[model samples]
Target: MSSPIFTTPDEVEAAFYAALAHADLDRMMAIWSEDDEVVCVHPGSIRLIGLVAIRESWRQLFASGARITVSATHPVRWSNLMTAVHTVHQHVHVEGDDRLHPPIIATNVFARGALGWKMVMHHASPAPDMDNLHSNDSPHIIH
Candidate 1:
């Protein structure tokens, strides 16, 4: 069966995580655009550009045979007619592990094409502690 056409960036993002949680390679790739400009940065790993590199990177990761539970929260988004940018706090729980991992900050970019909204870039990095994240709430000077 073929993948469903994602009509919105939200749909694409949802499918991306669902595929990841299941280690479904084909399904994950379906959410990404086929453009050579597409990019993905997996946490601390080097950036993967183009479909071939990205696919191979994911393929290697999925080979580990561990399921990852990804939950997206605290979303901040910006969109126009053709492009959209979404930033969210990503919480990951590895199946069978009890330790809590720090949240990750992720940015997903999507573009509209003939097929519909497809993700062009996904960049994720470790997020700072909540106190550090809120430290800049006001302008203060160190004595």
Candidate 2:
């Protein structure tokens, strides 16, 4: 079956996290652009470039049979006409794992092509330890 043409970068990002949680490699790859310049960086791992390398890496990971739950928050987005960039704080949980892992900082870049908005790059890294993720000096109300 042909993959859905994602209409927005936000949709692609949503699908990306859903795929990650389910270990759906095909769904994950579908969100990525079909360009030779596409890139992905798994935490603590070397960068993987192009569709072939990225697919192989994901295939290996999904083979482990581990389910990962990803929760992303604190998004910062930038966009012009053809490209968009989104950065967010990521919290990941492994099924059956007791210990909590540090949060990840992720950046996702997307470009509008004939197939609509497709992700061109995803880079994730460990976030720095902070005393609190919430601000103590500011009001908690959303404006």
Candidate 3:
């Protein structure tokens, strides 16, 4: 599939999760920047750098043929003309799993290039139990 011009960071991000829901590796990688420095860190996994490694990792994940759903919540964002950073809570559910998995905290960075916004980095780690607690300073909310 030819890459579509993703106009906004939100649009690219939406596409990112949509791709994950279907395990569409091509569509997933399409949201990433073509830079060799691109990064991805899955929950409990070592950091992966570059498109080649990233692609292979996703390929292996998809190879499992598991139906996975990812929902992004509690997003905090910062952006300029060329770069955007977003932190969100990723709520994932896998088909046939009875236990609830703790939400994963993810920071995704995007860069605006000639092809529009493309993700350059994605780092996700399992959120601690304390993070799931509601606080006076902030309420845990999902949009």
Give the per-residue lDDT digits (tens) of candidate 3, residues 51-94. 99999999999999988999899999999999999999999999
Candidate 2 lDDT for residue 134: 68
Tell me, what's the RMSD of every candidate? 3.8, 5.9, 5.1
Tens-digit lDDT track of model 2 for 47-141: 99999999999999899999999999999999998999999999989999978998999999999999899999999998855655364665545
- The residue-by-residue lDDT of candidate 1 on 1-143, one tens digit each, is 77679999999999999999999999989999989899999999899899999999889989999899899999999999999999999999999999999999999999999989999999999986668757777644447
lDDT of 2: 0.92
Model 3 poorest ten-residue lDDT run: 131-140
Q: Indicate the TM-score of model 1.
A: 0.89
Q: What is the lDDT of residue 6 in candidate 3?
A: 94
**TM-score, every prediction:** 0.89, 0.89, 0.89
Q: Measured by TM-score, how close is model 3 to the native structure?
A: 0.89
Candidate 1 residue runs with Cα over 4 Å from true position: 130-143
Each candidate's lDDT (Cα)? 0.93, 0.92, 0.93
Q: What's the CA error at residue 118 for candidate 3, in Å?
A: 0.2
